[model samples]
Target: MKLLVVEDEKKLLENVAAFLERKGFLVDTAQDAEDGLDLALERNYDCIILDVILPGMGGYEFCRFLREEIGSDVPIIIITALGEIDSRIEGLKIGADDYLPKPFDLRELEARVRALIRRNQLRSEPVIRYGPLTYDSRSGVFSCSKKELSLTSRESSILELFLRNPGTVFSREEITDKIWETGFESRSNIVDVYIRYIRRKLEAAGILDIIQTVPRKGYGLRRLRDDG
Candidate 1:
């Protein structure tokens, strides 16, 4: 899972980021609300840990902008020192899914994050089907021809992207940005390497022509026939 932590306290930010990273989550941190807003707008995240007290744009305003302006349904958890009823009400009224007060337990925070993600996943389409292949979002399982395809995390992420947007060509840069949250190295061949891995697995499963290379452009999923 991916998360964005927006906290002004440098030590707290680093601690939270490090803790979450150790928990196997791809975490990005912002010292202030502006940077957090920018990151939230630019990338996709399973959940956002927003600080209510910020330098310029406060968490309440940011949450409102994220929900009202950007129309993002990504779950948001507002963290604040103010734990009063009114404060919690304001956070929820503005569109935060959950609220955590200052000096909260990391384990509880992690549990809340997982619960929100699970609820969101339940609301979304769990399985995406293209021909005989199926991508199960809940389990991170990809299967073809009734056989489960063993995929590394990167391979599964790329395949899920293609399956979700069939026929839309994705440039290597786009893939790298989405898959590798941190920017890719200029000389990195990771994208091509993973594409080859996915293709090999698909071929082995008797699935063909699903992922197509657009000449000098990028890669895309071929439109599957209704009967395919």
Candidate 2:
């Protein structure tokens, strides 16, 4: 599975990322909320590890915006030093699926991730029809007609989000936050860069271009009918 770690502490970020990576997860990270939010929104991940307190936009706002505003259902695990009752309530109320207080056990964190993934996996049928593709979000697997292929972590995240909420127009800012978690550190042309990468991969596999551009806006993942 793929995960994003959004912690401001440089040492902690690397430490967590390393542990997760060692456990066979493809992991990425951000130093602060801005960077984390950008990466979270821009790319796709199986789970996001968000710090509650962050610079630019705080962790609470970032998590809230993602669920309430962007409508991303990507599982969230809030990680922070604040471990009070109210904090946990607030985090859960806003949309985090799980919460882990800092100074936590790495093994516990890994267990939580596996549990969440297992829970999510049980929610899916064998296949979900999204456009021409049949997606098994749980397995990170996709097939269409006679074609079958495994998806990369980034590919799975984008596809999963698109399938969950069909016909939604996603802004680059929105995409950046949802997928990559680099909301506030964008230096221009970055969103386009990833979009192009996604497009190339789909095309390389002979899949139709379901990701459509919106000129000055961002892109939308479309479910084109058999005729359309």
| Highest-TM-score candidate | 1
**Candidate 2 C-alpha lDDT tens digits along 81-140:** 996899999999999999998889987887788667656655745567865667865566
TM for candidate 2 is 0.56
Residue lDDT tens for model 1, 112-136: 8867976786578798788889888
Clash totals for all candidate models: 0, 26
**Candidate 2: global Cα-lDDT?**
0.77
Please give the lDDT score for candidate 1. Answer: 0.86
RMSD of 1: 8.2
Superposing every Cα of model 2 onto the true structure, what RMSD results? 11.8
Error of 1 at 167 (Å): 18
Candidate 1: minimum summed lDDT over ten consecutive residues — where?
178-187
